[model samples]
Target chain A: MRIVRTVADLRAALAGARAGRIGFVPTMGALHEGHLSLLRAARAENETIVLSIFVNPTQFDEAADLTAYPRTEDRDVELAASAGVDVVFAPDASEMYPAGFATTVSVSGRIAETLEGAHRGRAHFDGVATVVVKLLLAVLPDTAYFGAKDAQQVVVVRRAVADLGIAAKIAVRPTSRDDDGLARSSRNARLSPDERRRAAAIPRALGAIRDAAAAGETDAAALRARGLDVLAGAGIDPEYLAVVDPDTLEPMQVVDRRALVAVAARAGPTRLIDNVEIDPETGR
Target chain B: MRIVRTVADLRAALAGARAGRIGFVPTMGALHEGHLSLLRAARAENETIVLSIFVNPTQFDEAADLTAYPRTEDRDVELAASAGVDVVFAPDASEMYPAGFATTVSVSGRIAETLEGAHRGRAHFDGVATVVVKLLLAVLPDTAYFGAKDAQQVVVVRRAVADLGIAAKIAVRPTSRDDDGLARSSRNARLSPDERRRAAAIPRALGAIRDAAAAGETDAAALRARGLDVLAGAGIDPEYLAVVDPDTLEPMQVVDRRALVAVAARAGPTRLIDNVEIDPETGR
Candidate 1:
């Protein structure tokens, strides 16, 4: 895979592949199996696969979260090449956002006020939406891929692209998980061995609720209660456990249609999130 | 100029042009000498010149203002063609902003907060920034031209483009004025015969401030007072008269450096704005 470190370099590379379908996966560095899965999916469907590894600082609400985000450039480059990636754009913060960058993209009401958005501090989604739109513009991809791990983010970004009249198809790939069902995440690197062991309980708790709902539960409130009990049993500190409509991310009751049972919890200092769909009548 | 109403038609026309420098000017349909000057400037600098005539509804805060906004499509097309513009895009509101469109581009806490933005109510500049950015993206022009009559808008938009990391170079063309010093504008169409005569005071007011500053009027308050007197003498309803930093649009005292003298007023029911640069030491 070719490695590009500046916007100019990426633009030059992209110019050569103008007519073909370019599948793009934008990322923050510290690639894991999950990111590789996204890349592999892109390579399968596109004539040219372009992956960007930019740890956008604007999206981080906490300064410490920005600093704590892992960096593994040398390892990432090797993994990308091994995965048959055509190009990897790893831009420094300065290149992506110069000294005086000022324009921001914001979606009001619906996407910016539910689930994860409701709990997160101000402008977090705005930062995410703005950076993603910029990346999409820079790439001009025929198809852009986002992981379902950030399902709400995918919906919000899709809305942004559609609302802006950007001519790019968006795909939300399923969340990659481990043997214990834990959702793969870059922040997983922050967990100590003991914390990692406990973190598995997050997915396990979600799985328990999914299995219960799959069996018969239809009441969203009752399902939420079951999920909360599982989290408490696992000794996890729950931030929020919600059953919401998958499309709007607004909390819903009596899951008679497509819905998501999502959860966020802190196991030690590392925060983890996981969710599963509650199928129509069975709620699974 | 060829009048193209659809996005596809506009794109196809632009595609046939040589991949050389293209200059763009976006405007509402009513063409005046001011808009003609911008087209002329673009023709001089660019390999191909393109103009868009879309009366953007999003920018109008008041429905009555929108209804009263003038549109002279036939004259505009003829004027553009005579000025040597290669293509003109005149899209309907529905085509530009289809159903479900909901994204916005924002330049926060910058100079967009005062002057025209404050007087026009919230979401006015938001709409302007969003539409301008979208148009820039669609055309991908080498340079975009805007009139300096909207001095606050010029500064705010420049800031927006810079902040968004948009590469298109923005050039602020000189404000085109009439024989009596009234700024050229599409809204001038709404001015009654008497109101049109009175509207000349807006520019005269600006000119007086410029003259005062050039004559070494160091006090900002005194400069505003004199400028307001000029508007009052012409029987124009003065909304605001102030001296501000040319670049930041921030209110300034003592025009020791390059400053702008800006005014806004109502002649009958039509609001008019005008501005000029001042050199306090010279009082020119």
Candidate 2:
């Protein structure tokens, strides 16, 4: 595996592999099993696997969060290589954005106006859409892998690609989770020992709500209350817990159709989020 | 030259070409000498040349402008073939932009805020940047040619390509002008014979100011007044005549640095615009 730090260098490497099927997985460094899962999936599908590790500053709303985000360049390269990534591109912000950079990509409504969009500050998704467009253009991959852990992000990216006529197949990988049912996240490492232990309840709370919704508990308000109560019982500061349509991302009064039971909470200094689907027919 | 309308057809035709070099010229139909000059330049520089005549509706602010825009597809194909163009793509709006399109590209501040940018209505350049990006991606040309007659348009496009990190060399062809000094434009056809004759003076006025600047005229206000007065003397409704920095597009008060002597006017019912550079030291 080659560790490339410049867009030009990465392009040079990709040029030779143009005829081969390429799969891209873009990530901020501090790779965990979740990111490695995306890479391994890309490796399985594409003849040429390219992973980019750039901690995009534009996506972070809080300065302290941006500064505190983990960086593990050396370990990330080794992990990606072991996961069968063909190339690891680790570009600095300056390389991605030189002087006189002025262009931005934005979507007006719906996709950028709910759930995470509401919580994430202004221009957050604009930055995401712009950087993703840039990376997709640079890589020119046949398929790109993104985990469903960031569910809203996947929807926004898919919408951007489709609306803008960008040619790429986006494969949304299932969210990777730890043995305790906690979602595998880079931020998971930031959780203290007690916080990690308590984080298991986050997913467990979402599971209970999904079970209730499947059992014909059609009241959205009740479902939200139950989920929030679970997080509160776990001594977590519940940010938001809601029942929403999975595809459209609109709030739902009941699980009459496909719905997502999503939750977000602050467990100590680490903010954790998790979700589960409610199967209306199965009542599971 | 083969006229390809669909993206698939264009891709196939481009793929079949020899792997020497490819030059592309994207234009709105009703080709004049200026567009032909670009085609000629492309033919001279590359082993294969592809031209796209897409009068993108998204770029037009006025319905009348779009309606009045010429559509001479058959003649355009013949002219392109004569100019040795390998392929000509003339896609309908539906073929390029389908329903449910939501993404847009916007450049901030100066480049998107001057001359044509200020004159054209909202989302015009967004449409241009988006469509241009799409075309550049689809054609994958080694070199792309654009005329400098639309000076601000050139800067906006150049900034977009650089900001998006698109890997294509952009060549700005010098503006084509008539003997009487009117710049060549498809809209010039909208003018009556007398209006067209009067339009010639638009460029003539700028040339006189350029000559004055060459003779060591330093005050930008004086240069602008001279250009505007010349146009007014010709009975043209001089919209604006100014000496300004070429790159920044900011109004200049002194001609110690590089400047552009540009003019826009209403010749009867038709609007005509023209410009010339003032290089104080070289005295062109």
Candidate 3:
């Protein structure tokens, strides 16, 4: 496997492989099972797999959160190699955004401005959107893999790609989970043993809403209460417990169609989010 | 040349040409000497040339201006073919922006929000930046040609391309002009015979600034006054006449280095803008 740090080197590395399919997985450098899953998917689908490990500073609303974000470069490189990544693009902040860089890619309206946008600030998605555009352009991947854990981010990215006519296809894989049903996240590693157990409540809370919605509880208020009950039992008060349309992220009073039950809360010093999609018709 | 109205068709058209260098020139339809000059430069350097004629609605601040914007498709195709364009990607509004289009590409700071941005509103550059991104992605050209007539726009495009890590190299061709020293523009067709004569003074005013700067004039106010005097002689009251940094578009109090004297005014019912770049050392 080859590791290239500059955009020019990345392009040069992929120059001869243009005729074949290129699959990409973009992530911050803490290689967990979730990230490896994306890399594994990319490995199976394409002639070349490119993994980008850049902790995009723009996406972080708080400097402390950014500083605290994990950076396991050596471990990540080993994991990427094992996952069959042909090339790893690890660019520093200055290399990715030189001096005088000022462009922003934004997806406006509810898809981007609600839920996570509300909690993280609008700059969160704008940062995500901008960095994604840069990564997609740099990689020119035929298909890019994204986990369903960041559901709103997936929606925002899909909107930005379609609206801007980006050539790559976005493939959303199911959210990776732990044996305890906790959704896998790099931040999960930062949790202490007690915090890890508490983090499990987030997914359990979402699971309660999913189970309720599947059992024909269509009223959003009632569904939200069920999820809140689960969180309350674990002594957790969520930042938000929303029953929203899966696509638009707009709150739905009645879940007549597909809906997403998402929850966010602090587990010790780490902030984590988890979600599950529920359909009124099929319940699963 | 082959004309592809859909992005899919455009990609299909350019698929085989990817092995060779592709140059792109994006413009709004009513072709003129300015657009053709860009095409000619593209023809000389690239193995294949793609020309896009899209009068993007998002850029227009006034509905009346958008309505009055001339579109001569048949003539444009002929002019493109004569200028050696290989493929013309002419997408309709619906093709470029389908119903749910919501992404905007913006270059923040004075580079985008001042001068033309100030007069036309921020949405104008947002629109320009957005459509240009869509077009560039659609073409995936090695180099994209932009006319230097829209100087600030060139700066915006260059900034957007760099910030986004877009692979295309931006080439700015010199502003094409007429025998009367008027900058060639698609909007020039809207000028009446009397309005056309009055429009000539716009360029003359800029020329005065350029000439004065060459003769060691450094004070921006004096340079602006010299240009304004030329407009006054023609009985035209400009909407804006200021000296600004060529790259940043920030108002300059003194012209110590390269400066741009830009002016905008109404020629009868038509709004026109013209500018000339000046260097204190070698102002020609």
Candidate 4:
């Protein structure tokens, strides 16, 4: 695998990659199974696979969280290589933001205002959208792989790619999970050992919401209440637990069709979010 | 020249155009000498030239201005073909925005605030940046030509392209003007014959500011005062008259090295904007 640290080098590598189908996976490096899953998907699907590790400062709503975020580069490169990634792009913040950087790409409206977006503020999504565009343009990937773990992020990115008329396809892989049912995330490692045990409630709460919806309880408020009760029952108070349209992220009053039940909660100084799409008929 | 009205057709045409350097000129399609200048520059510098006429509604703060905007498609195609344009993309607003379009590209901070941006609001710039990105990604041109007549517009678009890490190079052509020296613009057609004659004050004011700065006028306020004086002498009250940093568009306190002297005035219901870059050393 080749490691490129500069934009010029990244583009030079991509110039030769145009003849083949290129698949991309962008991440903040900690090299968890969630990231590996995306890389593996890209590897299986394209003749060329590129993964980028950028601890984008703009996306972090809290400075301490950014500082506390894990950085395991050597292990990450090894993990990427094992996952069959052909090129690993590790760019510093200076290269991405350079001096006089004043433009930002934003996805607004309902999708930008609920759940995690409401808690973290629009800057988080702005950071995500901007960096994603830069990465997509840098590689001009034929297909970009994203895990459904960050479901809202997938929605925002899809909106950007489609709205901007970007000439690329977004392939979302299934969310990777731990044996405890906790969604696999870099933040999962941040959980204290005991806190890790409690983290399973986050996904379970979403699962319970799906169960209620599948059982013909389609009231949006009731579905949300059921999910909240699961978290509340576990001595956990979630930031938000709501039912929303899968695409627009607009809160729905009733689950008349497929909807996304998302959850966000804090456990022992770590913030974790997980979501599931609930078909009104099947529930999961 | 072939006229392509759909994004799919445009992309299909561009796919085969990759072997050669493509130059693009995006326009509102009133097709005056101003747009012709950009087309001519693109024609000279590239093997393939793609011109688009999309009077993006999102960019217009006034619905009336959008409605009033001239669009002569048949004549536009004829002019483009005569100027050696290879492809003309004339997409309707629906073709561009469609339904569920929720993403926007914006340039914030000083550049987005002064001049036309400050006068028209950020929505004007937000619309411009969003549509410009869509067009740039649509064609993936080697170079895109823009006229310096809309000087601040040039700055905002350049900032967006650079900040987004878009691959295309931005080439700013010299502003085209009438024999009387009024800047060439589609909006210029909105002026009454008498209003057209008065429009000369716009450029004359900018010229007077440059003359003052060239002749050892180092005070920023004094430079702006002189520019404003010329407009005032013509019985015109400008929306804004100032000397600012060329790149950031921040109002300068003193003409230390170089500054942009800009003005906007309404003459008989038509708004006209003009600017000139003046270096304390060269002044023109």
Candidate 5:
């Protein structure tokens, strides 16, 4: 795998591959099984697979969280090489946000205000959408890979691409999880053993909601009650437990079609989020 | 000029021309001399010139203004063809904003909160930035053109392109004006013949401010007073007359380097905007 640190170098490298199809997977380093899974899908689907690992500072509302977020650059490069990655774009903050930089991409309305967006600071989705656009343009990918772990993010990104007339197809892979049922995340490495055990409740709550939907519980308040009970029983206090339409993300009183049951909880000092998409029409 | 009404058709036409450089000039289709001047610049600068005439509704704060906005499609096509435009993208509102459209581009800060942005209501610059981005991505232009008459728009678009990491290089031309010194605009066609005579004061006021700055008058308030006096002398009640740094658009008390003297006023029923860029250091 060839590693490039600057945008110019990446573009130069990509210039030759313009005629071929490219699959891009953008990450914030500390690659886990989840990120590897995306790389695998990208590798299988396209002639060229480009992975970018830049822990964008603008996305993080908390300074300490940003500073403390794991880097693990050497390991990340090793993983990408082992995963058969073609090119890796690892841009620094200075490279990503140069001097006099003042452009931002924000996706607002009913879709952006629910679930993870509600508890997280206001500009989180804006940062994600902005950086995603920058990366997509730099890579010029035919298809962009994303994990269903960030289900809401998939919606936000899709909306941005359509709204901005950005040309790229979005492919979502199933959320990766550990044997203990906790979603795979870079922040998961920061959890203490007990905190890790408690974090599993996040997935457990989503699972219960999904199962309840599968078992004919269509009311949102009832679904929220079931999910919140699972979290509380496991001593994981949730920031929000919501049942919303998968696309618009507007909270639904009755699940008429496909919907998402998602949760965000603070397990010790770390915040964890997990969600599952459900199709009420199929009762799953 | 090949007229394409849909984004898909435009993309298909642009695919074969991908090897060549594109110069994009996005306009609201009234076919005034100012827009034609942009077409001339685009024609001269790049291998292919793509012009988009979309009067985005999201930018208008008032409904009547949108209803009354001039749209001279046939004349616009004729003017563009005569100016040597290769393609004209005249998408209707439905073509530009399809169903389930929920994406917006906003550039906020000191630059977006002054003059036209302040009085025109919020979401004006946001709309321009958003639609401009949509057009840029659709055509994938190497260089994009803008008129300096809407001086703040240049700053906003420049900031948006840079911030979003868009590849287009922004190229600005001098504002096109009529023989009477009134800036050429689609809205100008709405004015009565008498109003057109009085509208000359808008640019005349700007010219006076430019003259004062060249004469080494460093105080901003004095420059504004001189500009407003010119407008009042012609029966034009000004909405705002201010001296600002051209880039940041922030109100300045003292002219430091290059500054902008801009004004917006109601000449009878039509509102007009005009400005002049000044280098106070050299008193230009």
Candidate 6:
């Protein structure tokens, strides 16, 4: 696979492939099962597959978190190559945001202003939207792959892409998870042995909400309480356990049709989030 | 020229032209000599020319101004055809911004927060940046043309295009002017006969500053005072008379190199703006 480090270089590499279908996967460097899943999905679909590894600094709400975020470039490139990635774009912060970079792409309203937005502050999504737009423009892919692990992020990006009329399709694959149901994430590497065990409660809590919703519990507050109980029993206090509309991310009072139950919590020094979509008629 | 009203149709029309150079000119209807000049420039250089006429409502800070803005589609189509435009994309507000649209493209820092930004509020530039991004993406032109009459706007749009990594070159044509040296603008039609005559003072004010700079006057404050004197002589009170860096839009204490002298004033009920770039060594 060819690895490029500049936007101009990335564009030049993709110029010849414009006539063919191009599938893109944008990720932060430390590749996990979730990222690999996206790459594999992209590989199966397009004539050219481009993988971008940029741990965008603007998206990090805390400096400590940004510093702690892993950067295993060599391993990431190997995994991307294994997944049949044709090109790997690894640009530094300076290349992505050079001197006098002052533009921001933002998606306002509930999709952006709640859940992650409430906890991480608006800058998080603004940063994500900005970098994603830049990457999409840089790649001009026919379709971009994203894992559903960052569910809220998928919604925000979809909103930004649609609102801006970006000519790229966003395809989301299901979240990749471990045997114990802990969502696979690069941050999972930071979890301690005991903390890792406790992190399983997050998925369990989401599962509980799904089970209850499937069994005809329509009240959103009741569904939230059921999940809160599961987390509390596992000795984990969630930052937020919300029952919301899958699209708008607005808090839903009743799960009349479909609802998303999402949870975020601190496991030792690491923060982890998990979510699941549930239907009242049937549980998947 | 064939006029298309939707983004899908616009894209379909320009799909075959992707092999050749596409030059785009984005404007608010009621075409004048200034817009015609940009079209002419595009005609001379590009194989296909796309003109978009959208009076974006989001860019207007005041409802009255938006209501008062001109919309002459028949005349605009005739003028665009005369100027050799191949296709005209004229999407209405609803077409451009359908239901649940929530994205905003903004340029921060001095370039976006001062002068016109301060007078019209930050929403003005935010709206402009957002719509311009949408329009640029829709046309995907090889080069986009803009007039230098709206100097600060040119700066803002340039900043946004560069920051976003948009795949288009911004070509700025010199400001088109009337026989009386007044910058040609669609808004000029709203001016009364007396106000139309008074509007010429705006350009004269910029000329005074340019002339003073050419004569080795380096002090920005002194240069601004010269422009103010000219405006005062015409019995006009300017909203702002600024000598600033052409790129950053920051007030320049000393014009050691390149500087932009810009002025905005009320000519009766109509508000008009004018600017001129000056170099101390050899000012045009």
Instruction: Rank candidates by TM-score, best first.
Output: 6, 3, 4, 5, 2, 1
| Chain B structural similarity as TM-score, candidate 3 | 0.98
Provide per-model DockQ scores.
0.55, 0.68, 0.91, 0.88, 0.71, 0.95
lDDT of 3 by residue, A18-109 (tens): 98999999998898899888988988899999999999999999898999998999999999998999999999999988999999999999
How well does candidate 2 score on lDDT at residue B277? 79
What would the per-residue lDDT of candidate 5 be over residues B74-180, giving only the tens digit for each residue? 88888888888888999988887888777778888878777888899658998888888888888889999999888888999999888777889999999998889
Runs in model 3 deviating more than 4 A are none
Every model's TM-score: 0.90, 0.93, 0.97, 0.96, 0.95, 0.98
Q: Evaluated on chain B only, what are the TM-scores of all the candidate structures, in order?
A: 0.96, 0.95, 0.98, 0.97, 0.97, 0.98
Write down the lDDT of every candidate, Cα atoms only. 0.82, 0.83, 0.91, 0.88, 0.87, 0.92
**In model 5 chain B, where is the ten-residue run with the lowest total lDDT?**
B275-284
Q: Over the stretch B178-278, how does candidate 2's per-residue lDDT look in tens digits?
A: 77667889998898888877787787778778888888888887877777777777777676776768877788888887887766678875666677777
Interface RMSD in angstroms for candidate 1: 1.8
lDDT of 4 by residue, A38-91 (tens): 887888889999999999999999988999999999999999888888899999
Q: Per-residue lDDT for A178-239 in model 5, tens only?
A: 99999999999899998888788888888888899899988889988988898888797788
- Cα misplacement distance, residue A238 of candidate 4 (Å): 1.1
State candidate 1's TM-score.
0.90
Flag clash pairs in model 5: B214-B283
| TM-score of candidate 4 on Cα atoms, chains taken together | 0.96
lDDT of 3 at A58: 94
The ten-residue window of minimal lDDT in model 4 chain B covers: B275-284
True contacts kept of each: 0.56, 0.75, 0.97, 0.95, 0.81, 0.95
Of 3 and 6, which scores higher on DockQ?
A: 6
Give one digit per residue, the lDDT tens place, for model 6 in B120-162: 9999999999999999999999999999988999899999999
> What class would a CAPRI assessor give candidate 6's docking?
high
| CAPRI-style grade of the A/B interface in model 5 | medium
